[model samples]
Target chain A: MKSLFFPVLLAALLAGCSGTPSKVASIEDRSVTATETKFVADKPLVETMGKPPDATSTSSSLPLPAAGRSGVAVETRGLVAPSTDVMGLAEAKAAEAAAKAADTGATAKSGGVQDAAILPYSGGMNQADMKDPASLLSKRRVQFDYDSAAIRDEFHAMLEAHAKYMKTNSSARAILQGNTDERGSREYNLALGQRRAESVFKALNLLGVPEGQMEAVSMGEEKPLSEGHDEAAWQQNRRTEILYQGE
Target chain B: MTIEIVGGATNRIPIAILPFLVAPELASGTSDPALVVAGDLGRSGYFKLLDTSTVSGLPADPESLPLAPWKALGADAVVVGQIKPQGSERVEVRFWLFDPVRQTRLSALSYTTTRAGLRGVAHRISDAVHQALLGEPGAYGGRIAYIVKHHGHYELQVADADSQNAVTVTSSPEPLISPAWSPDGRRLAYVSFEDKKPVVYVQNLADGYRRAVAKFRGSNSAPAWSPDGRRLAVALSKDETSQIYSLDLLTGDATRLTQGGALDTEPEFSPDGLWLYFTSDRGGSPQIYRESLSTGKVNRVTFEGNYNVSPALSPDGRTLAFIHRRDSQFHVAVMDLNNHQLQVLTDSTQDESPSFAGNGRVLLYATMVQGRGVLATVSIDGKIRQRLSQGGDLREPAWGR
Candidate 1:
């Protein structure tokens, strides 16, 4: 009778433990679940929560249950077993708690300071490939003498490379973006950038690049690479950016 | 521009043009002196022509340059010329300009032109006389500034009045809107949204100096300078109304000029300093309006286009050049305030900003070509147009005197 009574009590306790949710398993609805997506998926740590016992819902199931509920966190406080596995489980639970606390803390104060829009570059091309002088110079940027649109001779190598790339790669397209330094009026700059981009486009088309593969755009003086008040910065800003569209 | 006169007729520079130098063979049958004279003087823009009938009693020769009769005819100067065929496909042209007020020859010159170049000789002589009377160089070698945009971003640029030497001045990382120049032409005041909000910045051309001028709450855009350079008239939202307000550069105090819920922008001061010309959507689509300083009365100036902006008031306050959207593209157009005549300048390019030179003969505008913004200019007559393709493609050029 004593052994039967102990077994019956254990069964009841186990049933109750499987009914409640774990403390760390606070799953909110509408939050995206694990998936392959276009944007960055929910931060990596979001799905590290353990599955709950007897909870079939994949969308919103708690990790652990209370003592009165099924699949609650392992209740070592009242457990008769003094095994090391239980102790290891307890350490894991503690570590997860600490990690959650730290994550929340870091997120709360991540205010925007470096707020200037960084150039949006998410293509397959990496910085190393771009660092090669040939590749770097191959970028469709042309420099002009002050107050003149006549193409200079120095950009020949770069433009020729771009033309070659365009001729060889049928699927690749390039957008030439004309830019200017802070010198004239906004409207004037916009028009000037357009003129510069058009000149480059015509040059490319004349040099064997397909007319249909290249498009010209004028950003005017709005996009500057260097943020200085000096002439060097101005020179750098006075450039045309050749953007690649899916090679 | 506000031109206030005691009797309601403003002051004007009285002037005249010389007769067109026609070959003796061309004018062999006719002795009409008026037709010859009108062509030369009208092109100069320095003279208000007096009718040959008004000076009906004046002598035809230079010695008989009847001073009393010319004065009665409102003639401030007289021009006499001789054109004879040189037969080398050329003609011998001799001309002299006389100041009727002083009764003496102010200047004289001679030129030999090929038969086909006779008109060219006439224009050059007209330009010379125009320069002499105006004391300032004629508008023969000047430029205009205006605005232009491609897919994104605005460019304020400068180009020759004939649309040559188009150069970009301010290329921003964001959209640039209005561009106005200081009276001295050293700095350009324009609106750029670099901080993600419309802010006015004055950029110095001499030393790449750029700094925020006004960052008021809401929009601090549409900056126009007073003729004296002491104040900047801009459209602000601090009053919860997009009204015209003048900001004191030294003290940074903004003074409201209009009080209403109507959205008012594009404030340009009349040359006389007594009125402000701006655009308001109060009645409907954007139209140019003038608000009197002394009387606080508002009057509409533009009626043809549903959309018009970037008004460039001629130095004499007689003409207003602005942009109007038509057929899905904007083109620069000028309005004769007295006659209310409107003329579109560009064909298909999106002309964004337009400004006039001090002489009021040249206009600078910005337009897009080949996807980049470029500055262009045209004479009000719509003839003698050229394009300026300066490096770093530009837009929104403001021409100072």
Candidate 2:
């Protein structure tokens, strides 16, 4: 009876010891396990926080010069492991982060001041291309309602694209020629045409295009695209044409 | 082409104009003076010019006037003239007006002029005949300043009121508009677009010497001479929007006369030199308005239409002529200042730049004919209408007082 009682007591003690880490384990194993466990627990916390635990921590302390030079900052907080595979995992993580950073970075860099650096033709574009009907730059004419200079919503995107192109090419210059239908007095039509040109000019200005790069002029009713005395012709006549320099 | 009367011939006074005789030596080379006289009288719409073909041989001397033939042709009055060559470059004209019914010699006048002045001489005779019969002054001898556009070339032309002897004052490849005559009719102030922008110039009619009177940064147009000819009422856009400004023709000083956002232009001074009549859109749409020169007080003069522009007060200050827009058509209208009754004198659409003749009986303006502009005139009473188109574009006609 004494021998059976001692074996049961030993089995109960071993089960209890295995259920929790023992304080008598080696420091390395304990520390690594503690850290690994913390990581598992903190991952959901980091995700819920929607932020890296330490934005500048992991990459800054690494001995990898290749990582620093890459400029591909990893937004996710990487887990630190006291194992031989950490270097390879960190590099691989960094590369993955870089790819993501590049994808997002591409979106923001477009139309940005930094974009001026990589534009075609020495940060400028061939002016002749602006006149090509198939080119996006050729879609510069902005139409308006009768006696109105207000820009329509449909033209917003086209103007934005133009604004972006103009922003990227600082050396380019453009002329906005405003026209009108043959209905009002010649002098009044001239003033109205000017208002239309100026309206486009102001929109471009708001989109980051410089004022010096563009000039507004009114051709009045003198130059009509269609001579028919009808609404359809008038609509076609009342438009502002964008012309680039030396094109 | 002959002058075809458009309207206004009922109850017209009867007058007979005989064929003017030239010296036998120069008859074949000289232009007939009777044609001009007949045209001038017929255009008035107040005279019934008799057919001279029905009459027998005309008398050369006023003493031997053939009253029986003229009276037999239902003539109330008769005009006979003789043209004699004064020299190689000049001619002497002797004209006589007769009252055939009363059988009396009314007046006789003689003028010595160059061959080119034959038209002027005929017009002067026509004026005399008009005054004698109608007991009122006539603008037959006066000059009309206008712009003629041919193949993209603009010519500032001056012609006899009867549309004869048209002389190009200055020809430009650019547009020239709004010709205003000096009080003396010796110079013309006009807007020229030589520099790709509107600029006002005053040119001497005799020598064609021109000087830019207003060349401000933006636009300088609608130049009107004051009564005294010392100042010009100009519409300038140097201060953002168009505004009326009195520019001293001698001192180069411009005084702002209006302060608003609406366009103020086409300034014309009242004949009395008291008010500056102009067109302003301050009342929401363009209307005729007058500003007192002394008090600087502004008053609205036109309330009949939403669009009235190009105001020109008659020499007597009794009538106001302007372009009135009605039902999308612009017509020349005249308002009697005393009765406040407005009468549209033109029946054509797109009539603009109405100007009054010195007699205030005829109003000359520009009208469109199948996309081309032509000069047209109407009697203030809307009785007589005539279009003077020589197959060329014409615009902005101003008759000298």
Which candidate achieves the best lDDT against the true structure?
Answer: 2
lDDT, candidate 2, at B22: 86
DockQ score for model 2, please? 0.00
Q: iRMS values in order, in angstroms? A: 36.2, 42.5
TM-score, chain B, predicted structure 1: 0.62
Q: How would you encode candidate 1's per-residue C-alpha lDDT over A53-110 as one tens digit per residue?
A: 3344465322233333221121000001000111222353464456422211101111
Give the RMSD in angstroms, all C-alphas superposed, for model 2.
38.9
True contacts kept of 2: 0.00
lDDT of 2 by residue, A1-247 (tens): 6445645654654443344433332111211211122212111122221121233334222122122222221111121211111122235345445542211110100000000010021234566656678766779789999768899999888888788878998888776767789774555565566668778988999999998787666566656789787899999999888766543
Worst 10 residues of 1 chain A by lDDT: A75-84
* lDDT measured at residue B259 in model 1 versus the true structure, 0 to 100: 76
Name the weakest run of 10 consecutive residues (lDDT summed) in model 2 chain A: A110-119
Q: In candidate 2, how many Å is residue B158 off?
A: 3.1
Model 2 Cα lDDT, one tens digit per residue, B217-298: 5557789999988989887766745788999989999999877877788888999999888888789888889888899999
RMSD in Å for all candidates: 35.4, 38.9
Alpha-carbon runs more than 4 Å astray in model 1? A1-247, B1-137, B141-172, B175-177, B204-210
